[model samples]
Every structure is written in structure tokens, then in C-alpha cells.
Target: MTLYSRVRPLAFKLPAETAHDLGKRTLRAAQSTRPTRAALSYAYGYDHPALEVDLFGETFPNPVGVAAGFDKNAEMTHALAALGFGFVEIGTVTPYPQEGNDRPRLFRLREDRGMINRMGFNGQGMERVKERLEEDGTPGVPLGVNVGKMNSSTADEAIEDYRRVFDRLSPFADYVVVNVSCPNTPEEFDESSPEHLERIFETLAAENDADVPILVKIGPDSPEESILELVDIVRELGVDGIVATNTSTTREGLESPEREEWGGLSGKPIADRSTAVIRAIAEHTDGELPIVGVGGVDSAESAYEKIRAGASLVQLYTGFIYGGPSTAKRINRGLAALLQRDGFSSVEDAVGADLELE
Candidate 1:
């Protein structure tokens, strides 16, 4: 086991968010020197060029990427990239910072291998996050900013909230993700609804002077039909791509004591459901729109399933928690082997290869 694996138990002793912060800080601290960079390159580098993927006008070194909400403030992009993620989407950042929910808001369910978090988009504001990115410079890999509304922003004001963040961070981002499907928010303001989603997208897309690729990050709670409807809207509006799934609210398949916790559910419980949604999009989208498959991806098999189903690229969050620091390398290596075994030359060619099309 690696050092991270050995210390994971101690890390897990803290609240999930605290343990996450500790890990992020550790990564950030380790990345400040040259020796660390060389060591990380040695530990995590994958030499296979066939894992390359070009999506939304960007070329990713591989399909495996780090999802948002892990580095909610864009603090560790360089460090994460050093560890071998092909791309890193940082933050569900808002125009303003908020503390999110109170403590005990995060819970771990080891038995069923899941986590529940009502963190409520708690993060540093866009300005500070952008500063971090500026100081660190963009990661060697493609860097994306995942923008969300401030906690206090009303649904009616959603477009304004998203607009400001997009304008501020767009210049520094290779791409921007408008997050409309965070499950921890209060009810009666479902931003993921067709009406709100359109308004939000139109608002941000209009103000995009950088005209950087803009993506929509949806939640896994969406029913299959709902997913297709959104995909159609995204394509119609010319949204760059869909980041297929945030976290699920349904405890539909989780079997843990903390399953009773009220928050967004991620990790293993979301695997099949998220993958099914991605598959439906592949089938319904007819290979026109691209997909960034998230949710329940902690292994090469799961990541490959998403790729074969239709994802041009894949991202993960909860898996890192369970897989420890070397998780990206492990999965990337496994993906390289799987790609050769499956007779595919590159990740781009693997996209949508398994859809049951007419």
C-alpha cells in the first residue's frame, strides 16, 4: 500500500470534508517544488498516447479526469494534474463564498461504499479561486471551472449569479461548466428544469466573450426521460457538452446506516443508475452531442463502461476518496490495458461504440 493508503484510516477519522481538505492541502504542499514534480511524474505517468481524447475543442491526454467538488476552490489543480488526471474541473464556485451547511453535513457509509454530503456548494468565491489558478498558472492538462450560484442566490436571479461567475473565470479557463443540478439545495427552485436550465445557459453563453467551451453539469437524480430532454435542449442551444451527473438524492440502492443522512449521494450507489443515464443519452443523442460521464466511476471497468456507452471523457470524485491518492494512476493504467485488449486505438474511437442504435 502507498503512504496515502496507509494513512487513509487516520484521515477518515476526521469528517469527510476535513479529511478531504487535509488530502488537498497535502497535495498542494507537495507540488511546490521540483523534486516533487519529478517524483509525481515518475509515480503516475502513463505513456500511452492512445488514451488521448479531443472533446469540445480541447485535447485531453486521457479520458480519465478529476471531477469538480473535490477541489472546490481550484486550490489543487496543478497537484492533481501532477498526479496524472487528463483534465481537472475545479470548483462549483459561486460569485460569492458561503460556509455551506453546518458540520456533520458529510457522512460515510463504508458498508455499502457510499457518501452523503449536504455541503450546499460551500466554496471560496470565483475571484479567489481564479487568483489561485492565476498564481499556479493553468495546469499542464486542460483545466475547467465548474461554476454554480451562491447559496443565497434566488432561482429568479440564477442567470445573474451564473453570468457573473462565467464572465470572471472564463478568461482563465480552457472550459467552463455551469452546474445546475446540485442536490443539496433547498426545494421549489430546481435549476435543472428545462425552463431554468435554458435561461441559465442562455445567460452565460451570451456573456461568454472568451467563448470558451461551456458545459452543463446535471444531477444523477434525473429520470431517463428527463436526461434525454435536457440533452436535446443542450444540443438545440448549442451547449458544448453535458457533464452527465453530479450526485443523486435518491437512496434507491444504498444500504448503509448513513444512507439515512439527508444530502447528495455519490460513490458506488450511483454506478448503474448513472451509467444507464449515460447509455440513454448515447442512444438518444445519436452520437451528436458529447458526454462527460461522472458518478460512481472508481475503476477502469466502470470508466470503460461509460466510455463504451458514449462518454468521450470521464470524471470522478468519490472514487478518489476511496481509491486514495494513486487512484488516477491505477485507473489510467487499467484503462490503457483495457483499450488494447478491446482492440481500440484511442479513447476518441471508443466513444459511443456500444449504443444500441437503429
Candidate 2:
């Protein structure tokens, strides 16, 4: 294991929220020209004949991406991209900035190799994030902005909350991710129902005259029935894609001393379940729509499983924490090898290959 991975345990010991900030602040301070950034790019970057694929009209150099909630602000977009993610999704940013929940809102289940966060959409406002993107001299890779509502906002006013961010972040975002899955927010978990989903998706998609790809990130806690219902509504509205699934509400299999801490659970525990949900969405959408899988992915085998199960693209955040900077590059490299061994010409051909297994 690399030194980065070795040091993670030390960071993981602190309060989850505090450690997250320290890591983000550390990354944020490392400018684009920092040697760490350059070394990260060189060590993690990978390319091949079949690695390139287009999602939501944007061409990604590779399939592995950094999931949102990792970089809540836009500060690290280019730097993370420079770190070798094919795409780096920033935010879960609200219309206005939010303090999120109080201290001890985040937890780490080390025994389960997972994390739970009730962070409640803490972030700088969309305008500031957009402003940061505007000021960056370097043009990074494709970026997806995950927009969420303020902690105090009700579900009834969620659209206006989402709209304000989309309006400002559109120019810099290759796609806009409508993040309605945040379990920490007051009504967020229940808001992913068929009717609420339809309203939020249709409203966001309507606001974009440029055909900007609008997608929703759904929680992993919902029933399969609810997921299928969401698929039907999204398909009918021509929603571009879905990010399935988000952190879970369940706290199953947690042996971590901090297991009882309240937050949305993510990482190893949700790996299988998230991919299964992706498979379900793939079946429901019949591969017509894109699905970006984002549950527990710490290896290429996990990532390949997502692709085979039906994710056109895959993302990671917790996996990065567990595996360190080399994680994305490692997954991309292993995916290429898996494709070769499976006799698939490209990753796209393997998409939904696990559907039969499903």
C-alpha cells in the first residue's frame, strides 16, 4: 500500500466531519501547479483505445469519476481532475450556503470500511463555486455539478433552491446533478418518490434551453418499486440519466465504535446493494438512459461489476479514502484489463453484461 493509504487511518480517527474538512482544505491549498498534483496526474493517468466514452454529451477520457460530496465546493475541481479522475463532480451545494448539521454529524465505521455523514448539504453557495471555476486559469477535464437545497428549505420550495444553483453553475458544468437523495435534510429521503422526482427533474430540465443534461441522484434506501417508478417518470420526462445509488439510511453490519452516529451510510457495506440497484435501473430503463454507479467501489472488480451490471460510468469518493489517490487510475487500468480478458472491445460492450447475472 502507498503512504497515502497508510496515512488515511490517522485521518479517519478524527471526527469524520473535521477530518473531511482538513483533507479538503489541504487539497484546496495545493494549487494546480503543486508537485503533488503533477505527481498524481502522472501516476494515476491512464489511456487506451477503449477508455474513452461520452456521457450526457460530454466526452470523458475514462469511465471512473470522483463522486459528489467529496468536493462540496468548486475549489478542487481542476486539482482533482489533475489528480487523474476522468471527471470530478463538485457540490451537493445548496442555493445558499449552509452550515449543515451540528458537530458529530459524521461518523466512520472502520470495521465495516464505511462512512456515514449527516452533513446536510454543507457548502459554499453556487455563485461562489461558479466564481472559483471562472477564476481558474487551467481548463480541467469534464465536471458535473451536484446541486442540492438549503438545510432549512422545505420540499415544496426545493425547485427554486435547485434552480438558483443550476442557473449559475450551468456554464461550468458539463452536466447538472439534481441531488434529492440527501438523507440528512429534513424531507430529503421521502422526496425521491415518483411525483416529487418528476417535478424536480422536469423543472430542472425545463430551465435549460441548451439541452444541458439534467440527472437525479437517488438514495439507496428506497424500495425497488420506488426505483422503477422513478425510472418510468424520468424516462417519460426525457431525463438524461441517474446516479444510483446514494448513501444508505441503513446502518447494517457496523462494528465500528462509532456505528451509532447518525448519518447517511456509504462505502464497503453498500457496494453489492448499490450495484444491484444499478442493475435494476438498467433493466427498468432498458439501457436507453445512462446510469452512473456510485455506491461502494474500492477496486476495478467492483467498478467492472457496476459496468457489467449496467452503469455506463462509475464514480467514487469513499473508495478514494480507502485506497488513496491511485484508486481511480487503478480502477481504470483494471477495467481495461478486464475488458481484454472478457473479449469486449470496449467498456460500453460490457455495459449490462451482468444483467443476465442480475
Candidate 3:
């Protein structure tokens, strides 16, 4: 059995958030020295020509990435890259730091291979993240910044919040994701409404002097029609791409005792739904817009399925937690085999391969 498989039982004994913090600290230590970083790369990193993908004017070494919230404060990007992820997205970073929800806010749905969290955008804020990036330099692969407003910010204040974070951090981002879809945050205002989204996109677009590619993150529970409406708005404002999707609020088919926890649901249970959303967006946009598919991706087959359904790239957080440090290397290696088996030359060729047929 794998080392993580053996240790997971012990890790699960701790509160989910505590375990996560400890894991990040270990990774941070690992990346502190070149020898350890090199050792990590030698042991876990994998590459294949067929796994390369070009998206948002950047070449991803592979399409497998660590999703946001995993490195919410930008603490472990270099370590994650050493673990073989093609890219790392840091933050659902807000304009200011917030304590977020109460303790015991993160739960492990072990039986269902999922997790529920009401983290509420807890992080060291944009300025700290920017300073971290500036001091450490970007990781070897692409870096994405997922920006969000403070939980207490009103609708009008929210626009400024997003703009401020974007202005400070976009320089370091290969792409920027405007995260209006996080279900764990306060709902004092309709952040996902068409008018609010329009204001956000317009304001960010105006401030985007560097022309960093901007995308939006959507939730899994939104109706298909509403999703399409948001997609339409993104296209109207000339946004760069879409990250489909955020976690689900539904607990329809969960087996774990923690399934009923109050917050966003992520991991295995939401995989199919996320892929369906990707397919819908792909089919609607006629494969013209880029998509970074996320939600419940834990294996190569699952990641490949999203690509076939139209994801230019895919990200995973809970999967990384469960699969351990070798997750990306294993997934990327398996993807190459899957590509050849399916007669696809590369990951780009596989994207949207099933959309037209469906």
C-alpha cells in the first residue's frame, strides 16, 4: 500500500482543517531547500509529450493542476509543482484577511470520498499572497490567482474588492479567476446576478492594463440555463475562460455521516455534475471558449473524461489530499497511456472529443 494510504487513517483522526494545515506546513518545509525539492521532483514528477496543453496563451506542462483552496494563502505552490502538478492556483484571496467560519468547519466524508467546508475565503489577503509570490518567485509551472471579495463586503464594495486584488496579484498570475460561486461565503448580496457579474467583469477589464486572462468560477448547483446566461455574459465582456465548477450544495447521494455538513460539497460525488457543466458550456460555446474543469477529479480517467467533454485543463484539491504527493505524476502518466489508447496525439486533441458526438 502507498504511504499516504497507510497514514490517511491517522490523518483523518484530526479535524479536517487541522490536518490540512499540517500537510501544508510539511510541504512548505520540503520546498524550503533545493535538495528536498529536487528529491521530491525526482520521486514524483512525471512528464510526457502527449500531456502538454496550450491554454490562455500559456503552455501547461500537463493539464493536471491543483485547484484553489488547497493553497489558499499561496503557501505551497513550489512544493505542489515539485509534486508534479502542471500548475497551481492559489487563493480565493480577498482584499483583506478574515477569520472565516468557526472551528470544525471542514469535514471529511470518508465513505463518500468527499469533503464539506465553509471556509468563507479565509486567507492572509491579497497583499500577503503577492508578497509571497514576489519573495519566492513563481513556481515552475503556470500560476493562477482566484480572487474573491471579503465576506462582509456589500455589492458595491465587492467590485472594488475584486479589482484591488486583481490589480495587485494579476502580474503574477498566468490567469485570474473571479470567484463569485463559492457557496461557503456570506450571501448578503446576489453576487452571481447578471448585473453584478457585469459590473465585476467591466471593472476588472478596465483595470486589466496588463491584459491578464480573466475567467469566472461557477457553482455546480446553478440551473443549466443560468449557467449558460453567465457564460453568455462572460463572452459578451470578452473574458478569457471559465472554471466549471465550484463545489455543490446538494447532499443527494452521500453515504458518509458528515454528508449533511453545512457548506460546499466537493470530490467524488460531484464529478459527473462538473463534467456535465463542462460539456454544456463546451457545446453551447461551440468549443470556442476555454474551460478549466474542476470538481471531484481524483484520477486520470476522471480527468480525461473532463477533457473529452471539453476541458482544456482540470484541477483537483480533495483528490490531491486523498491521492497524496504522487497524484499528479500518476495522473499525467496515465493520461498519456489513455491518449494513445484513444488515438489522440495529445491532450489538446482530446479536448471536446466527445462533445460533438454527444
Candidate 4:
């Protein structure tokens, strides 16, 4: 059995958030020095020519990435890269630090291979993250910054919040994601409203002197029409792309008792739903809009399903927790093999291969 498979039972015993913190500490130490980082690279890194993907003006060594919320403060980016992820996206970072919801907010749905969290954008904030990036430098692979407003911010204040964090951290980002669809945060305003989204895109577009690609993260529970409407709005505003999706509040078909927890649902249960959203967006946009799919990606098959639906890339957090350090290597290797089996030359070629036109 794999080391993480052996240890996960013990790790799973701790509260989900506590276990996550401990895991990050271990990763931080692992990536602390050149030799140690090199050791990890030797052990876990998997590189293949067919896994390369050119997106966001940067070449991703592979299309599998660590989704936002895994490295909220930019800690462990290098470690994650060493573990074989093609890229790492940090934050939902606000202008200032946030305590986020009370303790016991993160729960494991072990039976369902899912998790429920009401983290409420809890993070170390932009300045601390900026300092860490400056100290450690961006990971060897592409880095993305997922920016969010403070939970308490109002509708208009929210725009300024995005502006502040983007201004501070965009220099470190290969691409930036405006997280307007987090279900765990306070509903101070219609965050996904067409007007609000337009304001956000316009504000960021103005602040984007570097012309950093700006994308939006959307949730999966919305009606397909509403979701596509939002997509239409972003496309009209010159937004760079979409992250489909965030997490879901839907508990449909869940067998785990923790399934009732009031927050965003991620991992296995949301997989099909998220992929459907990706396919819908891909088909609607006619494959013109770039999509970074997120929702229950835990294996190569799951990741490949999204890529076929139209995601140029896929990200995971809960999967990493369950799959352990070797997750990315395993997935990427499987992807390369899958591509060849399907007669596709690379990840870019495989994207949207399953789409059917009306």
C-alpha cells in the first residue's frame, strides 16, 4: 500500500481543517531546500511531451493543477509543484486577513469521497501572501491567484476588494480568477448578478495594467440558462476565461451523514454535475472560451472527463488529500496513456473531444 494510503486513516481521524493545516506544514518543510525539493521531484514528478498544454500564455507541464483553497496563503506552492502538479493556484485572498467561519467548519464525507466546508474565505490575506511569494518566488510551473472579497464586504465594496487584492498579487499570477461564486461566503449581495459581474470585470480590466488574464469562478447549482447568461456577460466584457465550477450546495445522491452540512460540497458527488456544466459552457461558447474545470477531480479518468468536456485544465483539493503525494504523477501518467489510446496527441487535442453539436 502507498504511504499516504497507510497514513490517511490516522490523518482522517483529525478534524478536516486540522489535518489540512498539518499536511501543509509538512509540505512547507519538504520544499524548504534544494536537495529536499529535488528528492521529491525525483520520487513523484512525471513529465511527458503529450501532457504539455499551452494556455494563459504559459506552458503547463501538465493540465492537472492544485485548485485554489489548497494553498490559501501561497504556502507549499513549490512543494505541490515538486509533487507533480503542472501548476498551483493560491488564495481566495482578500485585501486583509479573515478568520472565516467558526471551528469544525470543515468536514469529511469519507463514505462519499467528498467534503463540505464553510470556510468563508478564511485566509492570511494579500500582503502576507505577497511577501511569501517574494520570499520563495513563484513555483517552477505556472501560478494562478484566485482573488476574493472579504465576507462582510457589500456589493460595491466587493469590487474594491477585488481591485485591492488583484493590484497586490497579479504580478505573481500567470492568470487571476475572480471568485464571485463561492457558496460558503456571506450573501451580502447578488455576487453572480450580471450587473455585479460586469462591475467586477470592468474594475479588474481597468486595474489590469499588466493585462494579466482574468477569469471567473462560478458555482454548479445555478440553472444552465443562468449559468450561460453569466458566461455571455463575461465574454462580452473581454474576460479571459471561466473556472467551472466552484462548489455546490446540492446534497443530491449523497450517502455520507456529513452530507447535510451547510456549505459548498466538493469532490465525487459533484463530478458529473460539474462536468455537465463544462460541457454546457463549451458547447454554448463553441469552444471559444477557455475553461479551467474544478469540482470533483480525483483521478485521471475524472480529470480526462472534464478535459473532454472542454476544460483546458483541471484542479483538485480533496483529491490531493485522499490520493496523497503521488496523486499528480499517477494522474498525469494515466492522462498521457489515455491520450495515446484515444489517438490524441496532447491534452490540447483532447479538450472538447466528446462534445456533440446541436
Candidate 5:
């Protein structure tokens, strides 16, 4: 069995957040030097020509990326890259550091192969993340910065919060994601309302002198009509792309006892719904707008479904936790085989293949 598979049982014994911190520490150690990083690259990294994807004016070595929450403080981007992820998105970072929700906020739904978290955007903030990026340098692959406002910020204050973080971190980001759909955060205001979103996009767009591509993260629980309206707003604002989903609030078919936990649901249970959202957005945009599909992505089949539904790229967090260090290599290899099997030359060619058929 794989090393992580062997150790996972022990890891699971710890609180989910604690285990995550331990894992991140291990990854940080693994990336401490050039030789160790090279060793990791030799052992885990995999590449194939067919896996390349061009999105948002950047060339992703492959379409599989580590979603934001995983490297919240930008602590392990190089390590994750060595583990075979094509790109790594860090943060949900705010303008200043903040302690999030109380402890025991993250849980693993073992039986369902899913996770629930109410992290509330706990992060080291933008300055620390930017400093780390400057110190360690960006990873080999593309880097995305997911920016968010402080949990306590009001609707008006939220705009400045986003702009401040974006202004600080965008230089280090290949693209930036404005996260407005996190279910774990305070709901004092309609963060996803078109007016709020417009204000956010306008504020950030003005600060984006570098013209860094700006994308928005949306949650899965929203109705298709509402999602489409948000998509239209994004398009009108000249936003760069969309991360198709964040996490689900509904616990529809979960079997794990942790299902009762109050947090955003992710992984297997949300797979079909996430794909449906991707398909809906793809159809609505007629494949014109770029989409970075996320939610419940754990295997090549799951990632491929999003691609065919019109995702230019895909990201995973819980998948990496369960599937272990080699998740990206395994998925990317499987994707290349699937691409050849389907007669597609590359991932770009395969995007929206099924959407056209519909």
C-alpha cells in the first residue's frame, strides 16, 4: 500500500484541522531545499503533452490544480508542484490576519469520502503570503491567489478588503480569484448580490493596473438562474473567469455521522451537482467564458466530466487529502490515456466536447 494510505488511519485519529496542519508541515519540510524538492519531483511528478491546457492567457502544465484552502498561507506551493499539480491556488487571504471559527471546525466524512469545514477564511493574511511568495519564489507551474474579505467586514467595507488584498498579492498571481460565495463565512449581507459583486469587481478592476486576470468563486447551492445571472455580471464586468463551484451547504445523501456538522460539504456527494453546474454555465456562455471547475474532483473521470462540461481547468482539495500525495500524477496520467482513447489531441481540444453534443 502507499505510504499515505498506510499512515492515513493514524492521521484520521487527529482532529481534521490538526491533521491538515501536520500534513502541511511535512510538505514544508519536504520542500526545504533543492535536493529534496528534486527528489519529490523525481518520485511523484508526471507529465504528458496531452495534459497541457491554455487558460486565462497562461499555459497550465496540466489542468489539475490544488484548490485554495489547501495552501492557504502559500506555505507549500513548491511542494505541491513537486507532487504533480499543474498549478496551486493559495488563500482566501484577507487584508489582515484573523483567527477563524472555533476549533474542531473541520471534519472528515470517512464513509462518504467527503469533508466538511467551516474555516471562515482563517489565514495568515495577504502581507504574510506575499512575503512568503517573495522569499520562496513561485512554484514551477502557474500560481493563483484566491482573495477574500475579513469575515466581519460589512458589504461596503468588503469592497476595500478585496481590493487591498488583490493589490498586495496580484503581482504574485498568474490570476486572482475574488471569493464571494464561501458558505462558512458570516452572512450579515448578501455577499453574492449583483450589486455587491459589481462593486467588488469594479474596485478590484480599478486596482488591477497590471491587468491581472480576475475570476470569481461561486457556491454550488445557488439556483442555475441565479448562477447564470452572476455569470452575466462577471462577463459584463470583464472578469477573466469563474471557479464553477465552492462547496455545498446541503447534506443531501451523506451517510457519515459528521454530516450533521455545520459547514460546507465537499467531495463525492457533490460531484454530480458540480458537474451539472459546469454544464449549465458552459451552455449559457456557449463555451466563450473560461471556467475553473472545482468541487468533488477526486479521479480522472470526475475531472474529465468537468472538462467535457466546459471547464478549462479543475482544482481539488479533499481529493488530495484522501487520494494522497500522488493524486495529481495519477489523475493526469489517467487523463492522458482518456484523451487518447477519445481521440482528443490535448485537454484544450477536449474541453466542452460533450457540451457541443448536447
Candidate 6:
């Protein structure tokens, strides 16, 4: 009864952005070639070695990624890394093409599994996602890029639109988020203001010069003291992590009548408020920065409860549009059997292990 749960009831009868542009044109034609991307990596690859994960400097063969608006213009990064995504963030990408927010603006709360787009940062930008990542290359795992800023940019032209999509996709990024908390764009300023996130982390830490790794996506309806004052202005601008959440205008316990669709609000009713904003930014950065969590991820006990509430990594787009393609090999083989049933040997020794039982 799989096969995308029997074709997701005929792709949930279209118009959720046209069944997400016909599932990214069938993952851009099953990643065009190479024996059908090695027959989708021998039918949905799922590596184990306790699902390895190092973090932004690469080495994430697991940590269940695939977040940024589901392949927005970087068209199916190697068919979502041959469907067992261990990384694949694409874009909010802006610095040119946009045409967003109209035509039924994506909605399908299918009895609250959730989804209510308002895709205002619509893509096909950043030089066509940097010429489709220099003609289909960057995916053998880690690839994030989420950069955004052009819903009629202001606030000083949104810092040169995130310095022109992080100077054209940060050399095909292994890390680079910087999406000022999208609630479906256009608020005309104060994009998480602390002086506009310190002029967007001091202009992307001075155009980063290949120091890449520069995360920051935040948004779960704020107030945890304004999200710890934007995580102390993202740890006083040395920024290199934090993507806790980025979709939710909050519809409160929605039962789904497209719950007054305005925008944002991603899967499974924003899973426990995006794991309580990744356990309040991992108990206020005591776990020392780096988070990546993402809202209401789909399985492995909700991505092992945001890697035990500190999320060394996690991401999902409406649970791979309702757990299809063996949803990251069934959530990284149930997160390596829930990290060896909790004795934990890897996944970075179970991230925060429920914040050392508080």
C-alpha cells in the first residue's frame, strides 16, 4: 500500500501548488540518468553506522534533511539524495525571479497533517539556483542553502537581498540559511529586528569569504523573550547555526478547514511548537549553539523528538509530502533503531539526550 500511499489519493487531488509541481517533475526525472540514479540508490538508500552526522563542515550521511521549500529550483537535489535524504536544503533563494503568492497559494491541511504555504519567496532565482548547482552536482549528502529576501525588498533592500543570495549560492553551500523567519514574507521591515539581525549578521559576516556555515531561520511565533533576543543576536554575530523553525503563524489546535489559511504553518500542526523551539534553543544555548531542528518533522518518533530536544539536525517538508519514497528510509531506519534503544552510540551520542534529563 505504498507507492506514495497509492499515489497519495491521486496526489491529494492536485493544487497544493499543483501537487508540488507534480512532485518536482518526478524528482526532475528521477535525477535524470545514471541508471535512474542507481535505481534510486537501490530503492531508497538507508545507511547506518548509527546514522553518522558531523555538521556544517560536512559529514551528514544522516540526520534526515530536505527542508527548504522542497527543492525550490535546485530541482530535486540528486532526487533528494536518491530519496534517503541525509541532506538537501535548496532555497528560499532570491535575488531575481519570484512570482509568488497567488493562485490558491498552496494549501492542504488534509485533516491537519498540515501545510499552508503562501509561498512568497517563490524561486528559480539566484541565477537559476546557480545554474542548477553548476549543472547537477552538489549532492552526495550535505547541501543546504536557504537564503531569501525579495518579497518587494526593503529595510535597505534587505541587505542587498542577503548579499545577492549569499554571493550566488555560497559555492553550492554545505551550509547557509539566513532566512529571517518567514511567515510568508513582506512585513516591510523588522525582520527579526535587533537592528535587522545586526544588519544580517554583519552583512553575512562580511560576505563570508568561503567561511560558509551561516545558519539562522527562526520563527515559531516568537516570545521566549523574543526568542532569547534572537539568540543574543545569534551569539554576537559569529553566527554559524540555528534553524530551529521557520513556518507557523499559529492556527492554534487546528482541526483543518485549511485553518484560516494565511501563510506559513507547516506539517503536523507545527509539532509541539517545533519541539518547543528546540527545547528553548537547547535550554538557552547551554548546548552551545548549532541546532537545525525544523518544525514537526515526520517520523523516527518525530525525528527522535528533535534529537532529544537539541537537534543536531533534522528537517522535513510536510513529512515528504506525507511519508512517500520510504520517507528517508523510514526515518533513517527508525533513527538507527532509536539509537540502539537509547544506550546511544551515535547520532552524536543522541544529541542532547533530553538535555541530560534536565
TM-score of each candidate? Answer: 0.96, 0.94, 0.98, 0.99, 0.98, 0.35
Candidate 3's residue-wise lDDT over 104-218, tens digit each? 8999898899999998888999888888999889899999999999998999999999999999999999999999899988898998888998999899989988889999999
- Clashing residue pairs in all predictions, respectively, total 0, 0, 0, 0, 0, 1
Sliding window of 10 residues with minimal summed lDDT for model 2:
187-196
lDDT of 5 by residue, 61-174 (tens): 999999989999999999999999999999989999989999989999999999999999999888899899999997989999999999989888899899899888999999
Give all candidate RMSDs, comma-separated.
1.4, 2.1, 1.0, 0.8, 1.0, 19.2
Candidate 1 structure lDDT: 0.84
Whole-model lDDT values for every prediction: 0.84, 0.82, 0.92, 0.94, 0.92, 0.85
Per-residue CA lDDT of candidate 1, range 1-358, in tens? 5887789789888888788777878888878887997788788777579888877677888888999888889887878888889999988888898899988798888877778899998888988987887788878899888888877768876778888888888887888898878888766577767788788878877887667998888777766777788888877887888888888888876677889899888888898888888888888878777789998899999999999999989999889888877888888899989889989988887888899888
Task: Decide which is better by lDDT, 2 or 6.
Answer: 6
Model 6: pairs clashing at backbone N, Cα or C within 3 Å: 248-265
Ranking by lDDT: 4, 3, 5, 6, 1, 2
lDDT of 4 by residue, 179-209 (tens): 9888988888899888988898888888888
Worst 10 residues of 5 by lDDT: 349-358
Q: Show model 5 residue runs off by greater than 4 Å.
A: none
Please identify model 1 stretches exceeding 4 Å from their true place: none
Which residue segments of model 4 deviate by more than 4 Å? none
Among these predictions, the greatest lDDT belongs to 4
In model 2, the clashing pairs are none
Q: Model 2, clash count?
A: 0
